[model samples]
Target: MNLSAAPAIEVQNLRRSYGDHVVLDDVSLTVPQASVYALLGPNGAGKTTLVSTLATLLHPDSGSARVAGHDVVREADAVRGAIGVTGQLSAVDDLLTGTENLRLMADLLHLPKAEGRRRASELLDRFGLADSADRTAATYSGGMTRKLDLAMTLVGGPSVIFLDEPSTGLDPRSRRELWDIVREIVADGTTILLTTQYLEEADQLADTVGVLDGGRIVAEGTPAELKRRVPGGHVRVGVADAVELDAATRVFPDAVRDDATLSARIPSADDLVSVRDVLGRLEDAGITSASVTVETPDLDEVFLSLTQPAAPSRTASTAKELS
Candidate 1:
């Protein structure tokens, strides 16, 4: 709902190829300022390739990427200055302390020594690394290293950030911690372009999620919208007695019944009318279910439905083979 038309990132008709392999074809998405956009895909789906091109780390055969109002290709310096990138792997150096790693970034940005030290100290505290600021990165735990790596990326105070699987190797707690950090960043009005193989991560963090399958966005929308597109949502009703269960099943033959739970899982009608109609019949028949709850397909369910089946309309992979 916060998707403003004021675009923070504009990518149009992007195309890229690897040697003779086509990776992205006619891909386009506009990210609103201060929103989180997640790029999700399985292996070889071009999620990495797309983010790399957008980050200006790799060149696209054709198409333009505009980040924070600067061209990624023509104005690479401006683009870099406006954005921060935390790649799939931790970029922390074992020899450096947490504060030193952040200082390295400040030095690269050419901040005044006083400003650099000031920013470093602030980021260390902001990222919850104040206790370990003096410890060598080599001695940091996995979560600590990741926190330090992320802190280093924020040293320059870039307005937009690119996070590619920031939580990939982290434990659940660490991942949750990273998620909290991401939320805090976005809350402060920084737009994010996130690439992750973890569907749950996308579900949890993305305001707008795009599914890249074989190099194209096969599906794109809010998490709930995408899940709603996939079928198989249902409402399960628990019947009070065996006689009521039999009557309910007779009314709806497609319902899956379980005698043990005294419940029947019926296909959802997606409307209150159908529910009221069914209940009216049950009431007339003197039958009742103990309770009912609507269950909808989740992100994992929707991802499998869109990506597992090879759709013929995919232009990216086909163009790659023929390129």
Candidate 2:
């Protein structure tokens, strides 16, 4: 991603409400060019609402947003021209064949007949649906249907794409295949804004993650950076014998030892300095055969901690302080 370039999507204190109920409250975020930014939250956390506002489908009640360098409210047409949206529900027409679907989307974008046919053929091959291009959408499996839906979104060749729960119902293998496709899209310089309930998906795909709760972005950072903010991180050291275990325990007095596994679990901040210190102490104690591994809280833990009811409002500075 080009850090020096203007962000593909930028929001400043964007807010939206439905009568007395606020769906998005003072939400602000930036999605870097040609990168994936994942929005994670509970069922009513406004992930979809945020995406809708950015896609120019819903007008924000307050604040401002720019998508693909065009204001979502003022330059709605320009924003629409530069982006594509694949919503939670599949946009594929069940009665249409795979190739017909792409061609239909191409036609809607005003491409010429020959160009529409070319794009349809190319998209069918690119998404591995060429073999079933003639089959109706109803005949395709869950995975194939989802692939076709995404392919239709790309028919316009948009610079920024919004995927709202794109992998909601697929099996594990299908989900992984979709992840690979998303990676390929980003590699080709497309910026993506994705919303998902799957914590692992965000960890695997996002360059940055924003945890929305109570209609606010409570935390935002890279997957690794957010994981480091949660506590309970430790280093596990395995020893060959009881003698070595005893020596290692002496070196780390506060470590939790397990006789059954002959390992010592030493508390750590999950940082390089703490890991280097542990290894240096083991070497000094002549425990040369020890095997070490660092363990830190995963995204699940980070999500739960940051979205707690009493969790304070967090800025980038607050996130660093927690880390």
TM-score of each: 0.80, 0.84
The TM-score measured for candidate 1 stands at 0.80
Question: For every candidate structure, what is the RMSD over all alpha carbons to the true structure, in angstroms?
Answer: 4.8, 4.2
lDDT per residue for candidate 1 within 10-115, as digits (tens), equals: 9998999888667787788989899999998887778778878877898888888899888889998898888888867456889999989999889999999999
Evaluated at residue 267, the lDDT of candidate 1 is 74
- Candidate with best lDDT: 2
lDDT of 1: 0.82
Candidate 2's C-alpha runs over 4 A off are 1-4, 237-264, 269-274, 280-291, 309-323
Instruction: Report residue 310 deviation for candidate 2 (angstroms).
Output: 13
lDDT of 2 by residue, 59-83 (tens): 9999999999999999999999999
Q: What's the distance in Å from true for residue 29, model 2?
A: 1.5
Model 1 spans > 4 angstroms off:
1-5, 235-292, 309-323
lDDT of every model, 2 decimals: 0.82, 0.87
